[model samples]
Target chain A: AQSVSQHNHHVILSEAASLELGCNYSYGGTVNLFWYVQYPGQHLQLLLKYFSGDPLVKGIKGFEAEFIKSKFSFNLRKPSVQWSDTAEYFCAVNARLLNNYGQNFVFGPGTRLSVLP
Target chain B: DTAVSQTPKYLVTQMGNDKSIKCEQNLGHDTMYWYKQDSKKFLKIMFSYNNKELIINETVPNRFSPKSPDKAHLNLHINSLELGDSAVYFCASSIPLEGRSGNTIYFGEGSWLTVV
Candidate 1:
């Protein structure tokens, strides 16, 4: 079974501060990665996704993540963050095959981000 | 338009009671999933249905059953609910499992279940 681990449980940052959230997965085959964010009272929204091709993928709201196969990591990064960026972020991984039921996206314990103004 | 939607945004029920939460998606996707988010915000997949067929059933208890009447609806029914079942349940849908470059899941506003 594939599992996802997020190193940080909570993160606090000031406005305009750079941010990085660590995420690592345990999978040996082809995998699809995603970063999803949920605001205070909103549903989970896709931040970005990495299927194939480039390792670095940019997402909405000025967020980006790099899919490092060697490190088994897909870390979310942003050079500058705003107060509105305060939310819970989750890292997920899924295998390439659909019939592989056990390969469904495995989510990590979300990281609560608090961005101070 | 809402791509995914779930009914009873807030559900407060007593223990041992039976309750059902309805989920619907208008995305014309073939795969729908149910995920539970605990108090600590740990998300886990409970069930997934592909084209009205049961595809993925995690180690979830039998008390929690998923019913998909069609391709767009996937409802969750909890029989004899327990306190541990008190969590936020999210319904999500993605493109058909057969023909897709990547599965991008869209989640609905979760249904917060509080078991007393």
Candidate 2:
């Protein structure tokens, strides 16, 4: 089974600070990557996604993720984050195959980000 | 309009009680998923149904059953619930990545289940 790992369990930063959350997947194939954010008491929202285009993908809220095939990592970054960016971030991966059920989708534990004002 | 919605957003029951969570998606997605987020905040896939057919059933206990009446609805029923079953359960749907449509999964607000 494929799994995703987010190294940072909890991250604390002040407003205007840069942000980078690491995400790594153990799958070696044509895969789709995604970054989802969940605000307090809200549903998960798509931050960005990487299918088969440029290695770097830009998402809403000035966030971006770079898919590094060599490291099996797709890390999310923001040059300067705001207090509203405080939320729980999740990293997910899914193989391209549709029939294989097991490889359908996988989500990481999640990283709780607290952006202080 | 919510893309993915689940009913009984909050469920509180005692041990050995049986309960169910209902989900619906208006996006006309063929694939629906049931995921449980434990207290540790670890989201784990419990079941996946594609076009009303069971496609992925993880190593979850048989006590948990997922039924898809149609492509847009997938309901999860739990029998003889345990204290460990107290967690937030989420319903999600997405177009298959192999499909021509963009495959972006959307999640519900989450159904909080508290089993005492």
Candidate 3:
């Protein structure tokens, strides 16, 4: 079974401040990582994903995440955040199930980010 | 046009009543899933269907049943709903690559179900 854990429950930052959200996963096999964001009264949208190749994957709205295989972490980062960036962030992992054709998708408890204007 | 869409964006029903949420995907994907998001924003996968066949069942209550009439449509029917069933249900679809976790998953707007 694969599970994801996010470090912060709630985060507050001023505009133009750097942001980093920690995410860790527990899985024994190769995994695909993802970051999804949900604004107020909206559904989850994909922020970025790491399928293969590059360790540092960039996403929309000036966000990026690095896949540190050694640490079992995929941390999301941004050089600066805007008020519009305020939203709930969720980290997810997809691991192919053994003897099954479908993938097992698991999501972490979301981290609410509030950006002060 | 919505790539993935679910019906009844907001549903309010009394306890012990039965309700159904319909989902459709125009993306031509083979895999469809039903996920529940609690008030605390915790997401749990309830069921998944690939090519109209059940693939994953995550220990969800038997009251909640998922039906896939085709690859493009998956419906969730809850029998004798309870207060604990009040949550946002999301419909999602994705395509499988050559054995790797599919590149991306598209999600619906979600159907907010409130059991009174």
Candidate 4:
């Protein structure tokens, strides 16, 4: 079975500090990666996704993630964090297949990020 | 407008009772899914419906049943609910047809269920 692992359970960072959250998966086949964020009392929203393109994928809110197949990792990063960036981040993966329903996503235990001003 | 919506934002019921969580997506998406977020905030897929047809049913209990009257609606019905069923239920939608672009899932504000 495929599984996703998020190394950090909680992270506290001051405003304008650099941010990086580790994510790794246990799949050997082709995969589609995603990063989703959930703010307090808000629904989960897609932050970025990596399909079959450049290894480095940029997403909304000045966030970006790099897909390293060799490491089985897709780590989320932000050059500078803001207080508004305080949220829970989840890393997910879906196997690529022609049948849409055949693709099931595996989510990692979220990392709660607190950006202090 | 909310692309995906789940009714009864909060549900409180006793064990052994029956209840339903209604989900609807106005995005005309072909695929709809039901996911459960436990108290620990770990989200898991329970069921998925594509074009009103059951496609992915995870290792869910038999007491939990999902119904899809149309492509835009997928409702979950639980019979003899247990205390373990207390969690947030989220409804999501995505395009599943042929030639569909990247599968981008849109989730709605979850329905928090508390079974006492």
Error of model 2, residue B68, in angstroms:
0.6
The candidate that wins on lDDT is: 3
Off by over 4 Å in 1: A96-103, B97-100
Q: Which ten residues in a row have the lowest lDDT in candidate 3 chain A?
A: A96-105
lDDT at position B77, candidate 2: 96
- TM-score winner among the candidates? 3
lDDT of each: 0.91, 0.90, 0.94, 0.90
Regions more than 4 Å wrong, model 4: A96-101, B97-101
lDDT of 1 at A88: 99
**Runs in model 2 with CA error above 4 Å?**
A96-103, B99-102
Per-candidate TM-score, chain A:
0.94, 0.94, 0.97, 0.94
Pairs clashing in candidate 2? none
Model 3 docking tier (incorrect/acceptable/medium/high): medium
List TM-scores for all candidates, in order. 0.95, 0.95, 0.98, 0.93
> Model 1 chain B: which ten-residue window has the lowest total lDDT?
B95-104
Query: Which is the leading candidate under DockQ?
Result: 3
Give the DockQ of candidate 3.
0.67
The i-RMS of every model, in angstroms, reads: 2.6, 2.8, 1.7, 2.5
TM-scores computed on chain B for all candidates = 0.96, 0.95, 0.97, 0.95
* Candidate 3: residue A71 lDDT (0-100): 98
Off by over 4 Å in 3: none
